[model samples]
Target: MTKRIRKAVFPVAGLGTRFLPATKSIPKEMLTIVDRPVLQHVVEEAREAGIEHFIFVTGRNKAVIEDHFDIAYELEETLQKRGKLKEYQALTEQLPPAGATSFTRQQAPLGLGHAVWCARELVGDEPFAVLLPDMVTMPAPAQRDRCLAQCIEAYATHGGNIIAVEETPWEEAHQYGIVSVGKDFGRSFEITGMVEKPPKGTAPSNLMISGRYILGPEIFRILEKGEKGAGGEIQLTDGMKTLSKHQPFHGVRFDGKTFDCGSKLGFLAANVAFALTNPEIAAPFKAELQKIFGTL
Candidate 1:
């Protein structure tokens, strides 16, 4: 029987050098896409995927993120006093039940693997998920599947290491860890190997790993060793590659629109994309966008 995945780890320690000044004080994950923060989007996605606990591996200047998830009595009360019932409930209701949220600091700028390993104790022995907040997935209103949701369901059926994947042009494959599949199972396939940022035209396959992963508890063991790799930082891809050798790992090519909010261009695009679909702003936003475009 396949094990159920109930916990999710979020590694949010990046400095966000790409966004610079704005991220200097604010955690990049706190950046707003439309109205909700990027970090919240990933949290909501994980919650929708049946994640019972949310563990965040944070870094310096990330205290705001923790507070964001925590309850604010004063703010809620103020909203209630103003007769903004929905606004009051929005803050009070969305917070994870007290014990469901956890935060651990990654004191140093370690690689992704180290950050994930930071949450090992909290994750314990259950099959857990690792979601990068930088990767924003947009699913249609009627769509029940989020990027991580697909990975979780795939794990329930396949019962091995599962990672969400998507096809990218060979030229762009070098930007991500490319996967090699021995057998193609359409939406999902058995992963033979993974190469981080292969040279252009040399990637084994065009399917690049998306930011969501469903890994077994054993991955914690590998990460515990904290082996330095690829730029001397512990790379999660390295540990995963080692795990792939000993375990049955598969890559699921999920359906969804993903935005890498780590980059300025991608971040702007995500805002526009999300805003275009937002009910309160969509009508006017679309008209303003068209008017601006016509002028240019």
Candidate 2:
């Protein structure tokens, strides 16, 4: 039987250098989209996917991220005194039980692989999931699972390193780590190999890796060596490629629209996209957007 995937590791230690001055104090994960911070959206997706224990591989100056999931007692009490029951419930509703969550530090700004390696001890030998907070995806209400949830389904069946992949235009393959596909499985495929930003036409396929992954524990051993690649950082892609040689490696092409929140333009696009769907602001927001676009 396949081992149940109960824990998830979120690597959110990057110093948001791309959005520098604003990120100078606040961790990028805490940046708000619509109303909640970016990390909240990732956590909510993990929860929806039946991830029981949330493990955040965080870094320096990220205490606020930890606090975001904890009970805000004073605020709760104030809400109670003011008879704002709805407000109080909203704050505490999504927070995981205290013991169900864990935070471990990624002491250096090494890379994605090293950041994931930071939580190795906490994860132990279980199959785990990794959701990159930078890529926030939204699926239509009619769709069953978001990207990560679908990735988990792929893991439960294939039981190895299964990552969420999406098709990009062949010409833009150089912008992302591309995957060479084999044995098409309808919903997923056997990931023959991965190319980190393959040179234009040199890319084997247009299928690019999305930020959600379900990895077997053996990948930890590979990441521990900490060898640097692509920008002198320990790349998780490197570790996954090594693990794929020995373990079953596959990819799940998710059915959702992923928003890249790592860049300023992507961030702004997500906010607008989210707001347009938000009931509270949808009407006014659409009118305002039309007014602005008309003037432009």
RMSD of each: 1.2, 1.2
Taking the tens digit of each residue's C-alpha lDDT, what string does model 2 give over 99-125? 999999988889899999999999999
- The per-candidate count of clashes, in order, stands at 0, 0
lDDT of each: 0.90, 0.90
| Residue-level lDDT for 155 in candidate 2 | 79
Writing each residue's lDDT as its tens digit, candidate 1 over 125-176 gives 8889999999999875677788998887788778989988887887899899
- The TM-score values for the models, in the order shown, are 0.97, 0.97
In model 2, the Cα lDDT at residue 229 comes to 86
Which pairs, if any, clash in model 1? none
Off by over 4 Å in 1: 140-142
User: How many steric clashes does model 2 contain?
Assistant: 0
Query: Lowest lDDT 10-mer window, candidate 1?
Result: 86-95
